[model samples]
Target chain A: MRSYRTSTVVALGLGLALLGTSAFAEAAKDITLLTWLGGPDRKVLDTLVTGFQAKHPDYKVKINVVTSQGDARGGMRTALMGGEKPDLVTNTWPAFRKELADAGILRDVTPVWTSKGWDKSLAKTWRDISTTGGSVYGIPYIFGYRSGIWYVPADLQKIGLQAFPTSYDDFLATFDPLRKAGFAEPIAMPAKVYAHSEWFETLLMRTGGPGLVTDLGAHKIAWTDPKVAEALRQYARLFGAKCCGDSKLMYATHWDDAADRIFVERKANFLQIGMWINARAISQYHLKPGTDYSLGKFPALGRGFDNASIIDAKEILATGIGSNPDGADAFLDYVLSADGANIIAKAGFTTPSSSVDASIYDPVAAASVRFVNEGDVRFVLGDLLPGSLVDEYRLALQQFIGNPTEANIAPTLERIEAAAARAY
Target chain B: MSAVDTRLPPPGARAAHRGSPGPAPGRRAWMPESATALLLLTPVILLFGLSVIYPVIETLRISFWEIRGLGRPRFVGFDNYLRLFSDPVFLGTLWTTLIFTVGVTIVAVTIGWTIALLCAFAPRQTSIFRLMIFATFGISEAVAGYIWIGIFRPGDAGLLNGMLSAIGLADLAQPWLGGANSALIALIITAAWSAVGLPLLLSFASVQAIPRSILEAAYMDGAKPLAMMWHIMVPLSLPGARVAIFLTLLSSLRAFDIVFVLTAGGPARATETVGFFMYRESMTQFNLGYGAAATIILLIGVLLVSTPAIAQRTKGAK
Candidate 1:
């Protein structure tokens, strides 16, 4: 009888030990995160992950850095389709987010959002974009003002400009003195798809405010609107006046090359690009922001319209179909917490929904914040379009830049509209 | 007739008497000798089925559907085909691919043939030259692309442009890769440069194996250098030239890596070939069904154009 009782006790002890070890193993799960965070951005993300791991001490986060934006979106789609999805993914464009939601790869984060009371921390516009079908699907990570121009400080000082222009007339007037002072080209305009689109979008916003692009993206307004046509005409006039470099040269060049010419060669006094371009310039050329160069909102078009621009949030990390829901929820909470936001902000990057103090930023970020707070900035137009329509627009822009004409513009716009209609 | 019948019966009986007479010499010659041959061939046949035949069949099957790498494939019949006709980018890529193929094939084969001839006829120093030229074949296509990119970069900091400027030819410093008109040409040059060494080495080996007696006899007959090259050497080396040209043509038709790394079908799609377009559709856009359709189109094009040349070369070789 004693032997039997001891045997039973031993069996129970073994079972309990096995269960405890399995639980510990389950708690130490490794999660894969797909992101485009490399270089300095990668270092920053690694620090944040380290912090999270220190607090949890049970989970392991493995990050796979995708080299390009295109690859990240395409790879995620392929992975989800193959049922080999990552635990978390970062996507830049809203179209991708919508596509993932439509495909049911994204977990509905509404409950998590509500449980965590994340709504109290996020802006309404950001929250609206993150929600689909009245349910939250994604969280915004980093945000930047897209429609802006960079100018060399020396050029601005030489031209007797005290500060960046706040209105369109003053913007053109500043260029006139630069042109008269023997600066053959005052701006370096790349005829790339995104570059040209940004130029046109900035011009439209300056002329008619952010409503024009927003309406166009929402299909409430046509591309052949009179304001758009006038904007195109103005773009052509600027091209003819040599206010920008050769369109063909620009079309053939990458954005980085254009940035290099502005920053290194001093061939052009100004360049219009996104904040990511600023990051690239600073990293590549070792230039000090606000000292060697300065940032300004894209020049305004007319008096009635306020200084307006476009804002684009970088991709957010979200749970995929194959993720451990509980662990993913924990990570999401960590990301939304004040600690995570502070870590990202201190690394010289901006989080979309985070309430970061502007005083801590460099001059460019501070200026970008001022513009976002004051100007009527809308979301990027292409990001708002359907994926198919975005591709169509990119192709159309390429074609237009290759052979820009009054005769070609209408047909190109018509083709794009037809494509957009079909997509919808 | 009576005598012949008698002899045939006698011969059959004699062969039966000679211990099966090596199992009828004709059968022995027709069949492979050992099980090892079949064993070795099995893996090759299986690989051919899996890599070559299966993908072709799967691509054709998927071309008829509306599959986009995600979800179930929906049969769309002729819609995908109809869309191909209407796709302006596809049309443009087709033309560009054709131009690139013809241009690269002609350049590579001609240059390779010339180098082969030099290696065959030139002095001992020509061996060094041959080795140097053949060394390029050892380099990967990606490395070749980067080397050419460094050479053809448009800025004043570029190697070629800087050299030209130093030589007081600053006026000649044009954007070699910065315009639609020049981008394709630049890509073709890089492709030809990267591909020349393979054909050159192959042709050189074939030329070296040519009977020296034939060449000596030609020399004895007072054949001039050009006459020997054009008439005697070329006709004899036709087999090698044929193989070289066929390889060059195929490589140029399917050229992807160099163009991908260097131009990526850019400069207003001037360098966009069918291969690059298919890659973008499948890999970049995640439009697998469309990519499959494009791939099917490319396979058909290659087969239709190349089969005849390959067959003719094989027949000539035999």
Candidate 2:
């Protein structure tokens, strides 16, 4: 009886001591951030929080995660509509940012941009892309190169090519020899939902340049525009080259399955995707970058838009409803600082801020940064379209992949046009 | 029917079957039976109105508006419904939902009823097998969907394709979920496999409820096993089968999770049902009015499927 009483007292004392210490160590002010990022991306956010808390000992970040699958936009909208007044939110979709801004959910940070001298670190292009209706709303901290083709160096060697193809014709020419070398389909096209559009989107940039992508995404140019049809024709050219497997196989494959075909199975030679494939290849397949595999920019189509690039960026947007505006502003500034940018680079993502050193990134990510610097970059087209139009556009694209002939291109473009008519 | 009931009932038992009492007019203040019954059910009535009735009314109200993506809703009256009827995607979903519901019901009920009849012959011997089959009913549809994804996955990595190659039938192996018809078929097969467990248990209970005396009489009359089963067990066990059909039809009409996990209403929306269409509209596109209209349509479908069975049961009770 005596021992039991003593143990209970000791347990209560320890609990109180731990609670008191935590209470004392707590920061005086806090700002909340809402996001749907998980896995390695979540870890990156945790690291940023640590670095920020250390710098601003009196301020803290409280992260509210909205758990979701597939598209995170739906979950974010639900959280906001359900009355979650987060101070900041990590966003990627320009159209989504526009929606939030139109709904009075986002705050214009142009004043912060001018006062904090953010133009020295971020380029004009980042600011321009982050702006909606002449008001800037977010800070783009990390970006991924979307136009690169992921391939094993050895697969190209199998067909006796010392390097990846440099032109569109040369790239298509490798399929026959690659087939002869026991690779049935040189490219694993994942049309299960969306990844197959990566090829077509880049081809659009190649054929019509970034301006056409911008115009078509905003429906300023109808989907039936000649430039759009010509881009689809260019997309059809890859199918004419016998580049992928049957329509059924493509329709059944997802991005992860295609990644397996490239890395684990080695049954295919190339996959066009964003920079997340680099992390996936390194961690999941345990392959080293630049040694076992490397990224190649999409082959030049020899159009006037040969230098254009397509990319996706993760941006932090300020909200209009939070109480801790100061804490949120300080966090945004720190994200662009040298320390924050380096932490991002260390986590295997490329940062847009000039403060980040190129040496901190892995070879693949470094190449992506170099490629972005070498071209005019546009956000990935799918992320720029409204929600209503985007679904219809992808579904129409799916139908086109089923039969990628010249005859099918016009009808496909018309289908997307019909949806865009109602979207706006 | 009257052979076993010739004995007389004692005292109050005779009058008990006829009436409790017409009215308590001669007694002290008394409450009517109907009124007393309603009083007893008040809590349940209120609970039902709160839990089930209010949300349905709210949904119907929302279906009349034009609510789009957190935007201010304008009352559009019947425009959303009119749009749904004309929309090719929604029309396609109705057709797909019909085919999916019918396909799942036919496949599940047939297999379950057949297996249950066979299991009735030796319940003790097949106890483990019956348990295993019924256990599948307890599995979550989402988990079952992922398991089928591995089986139906494209290329040689998939189990079905691998088995085909092992059997020297490699030419027959195709992407089961890639084509339109094939994906719908695969979805039906998965839904039926998941749904069969319930019908099996229900039909088996009904079969077990068959009186032993009848089976013995049929056997003593030199009836064959198949004959006794066809003539005796089939008709007697139909009430359970009817209930199972009503239930399976209701569930299959609202099928979403399996389709979501399996095909996601893809390959150009070939396998999309009304439930998935509702989700895509409401949750994904944030078209609350349009999605609510779809839900109300699905609810009507469920009522149509269930009304016949319910009417027949109600008539029997009367």
Best by lDDT: 2
Best candidate, DockQ-wise? 2
Q: List the pairs of residues colliding in candidate 2.
A: none
Classified by CAPRI criteria, candidate 2 counts as: acceptable
Q: Lowest-lDDT window of 10 residues in candidate 1 chain A? A: A66-75
Q: For model 1, how many clashes?
A: 1
Number of backbone collisions per candidate: 1, 0
How much does each candidate deviate at the interface, measured as C-alpha RMSD after superposition?
Answer: 2.6, 1.2
Question: Once superposed on the true structure, which residue ranges of model 2 sit more than 4 Å away at CA?
Answer: A1-28, B1-47
DockQ (CA atoms), all models: 0.34, 0.48
Fnat of each prediction, in sequence: 0.33, 0.52
The residue-by-residue lDDT of candidate 1 on B140-251, one tens digit each, is 8779988987787655656788899999999887667767878888888888888788778877877888899988999999999889888876677766777777887777
